[model samples]
Target: MSRWSSETSKKFILVFVFLFLLYGCATAPVTGRKQLILVDPQTEIKLGLQAYEEILKKEKLCNDPTINALVQRVGMRIAKASGKNYDWEFKVIDKPESINAFCLPGGKVFVYTGILPVAQNEAGLATVLAHEIAHAIARHGAERMSIAMVAAFGEVLAAELLDLNNSRTRELFMAAYGLGATVGLILPYSRKQEYEADTIGLYLMAKAGYDPREAIKFWERMRQAASGRRKIPEFLSTHPADGKRIQALKNLLPQVLPIYEKAEHKYGLGEKIPEPHCR
Candidate 1:
């Protein structure tokens, strides 16, 4: 029947279009790894912006003028050297118990007050800002979301192929991608990506006139911070520890040392950052 043939042809065309879209993937900066990101950059940035606004609304901001100014100063320098064209904003959270820093996509950075004691000074804070900004410049969060989109797409395609009339499949797909812990815990970046961020971050910090070597010291302090940690929470579950991460950075120091030296020379030698120890 002509009508039956027309319907079959339409389905074929749809499948062809789906495959074409899948083939058009993008490469990650610095690492140059091919990624199957179904979502556009605009979509990813919108989500990041929304998430950032939600966090600021929920968290108590640090009221200290000096601390806020310091964070903003260092954050701006790093953002400039990141070579990324995005609306950037930095905030210092008043939370004293949680020692963490994060840079969400589209240049949203947050530094908890608790981490400042460990950072000790301006250069130390620069180290934290540099690493967090590296995550944004490298598009690590976007890459993770892209992976989730691909997984969800696969689930839908699989369900259709199986001829399964199940709403649970759609629900499960949402659950998998919706949970940040999903990729953070199980499927993380290739070791290559971790190393790439370190290398790229060092250069960014150096160009920003911060001592890149402080990153090494910062991680050492982080390792000491997590030494007695018994259990991993969903958030910490995704990131690698200070020891493995620091060692990798050390190995790449030879390549980045010149950048550090230039930064130190240009910025004038800064006082040595003091090491932190847990009581």
Candidate 2:
């Protein structure tokens, strides 16, 4: 009787997982990659808005007219090219030491001052902005969150079914599962997303009239900037190696160059970025 019950439980779990995956299946934009995103778009956007509001309240915003103008100019162009009807907003963060930029789900983009020098010119800035916008368009944040939720549920189910009565054994099992899932599933998916973003971003920048080749140069400069730092292995890190990213961008130039040429208003790198004097 107990064996029959166990078999029934196993079958039920399998059926539930199959249904869950089928219900949550979605395809990413541009790449057409299928995804398992259980989170709804409305909830994801609400979370993004809340996070954006909290971040803006905490971070010092750059008030320099020149910097603001540059960011808005580049960001809006990329946003327009994306064809996503997001409530786009762009702001420069006054963090001179943090070299980063990100876009929230609803198209809230924030660029740190430190990354501007690396961006150097308008096309380079467009590379950064377009990549971030691609992340939002692809719904990567919600996808990641859904992956985490599924992982957690799997862990709980495993614990219950395995009958891990010994505390130490249960701990070991959970730890192993966490490590395996992180190394095998989450990290690889993150790298894939980064590569996907690079692809979509290249298309976006070209469509928006920026030279797609500048992306390679920008990433090359980034590689130089990180020359002295200890490198994380590509397998372990969420982002791909800078060299790999540069190579990928180089490989993609052939496809995007035609798009750039056909763009209605070619900016050809536009204006050089000026140093911000935050008021």
lDDT of each: 0.62, 0.75
Q: For model 1, what is the alpha-carbon lDDT of residue 17?
A: 63
Per-residue accuracy of model 1 over 137-169 as CA lDDT, tens digit each:
666655554455445542344324222134332
Q: Which residue pairs clash within candidate 1?
A: none
> What TM-score, computed on C-alpha atoms, does each candidate reach?
0.74, 0.79
Which runs of model 1 end up more than 4 angstroms from their true locations?
1-24, 154-190, 229-237, 263-279
lDDT of 2 at 43: 56
Which consecutive 10 residues in model 1 have the weakest lDDT in total? 169-178
Error of 1 at 64 (Å): 1.0
- Error (Å) of candidate 2 at residue 178 is 19
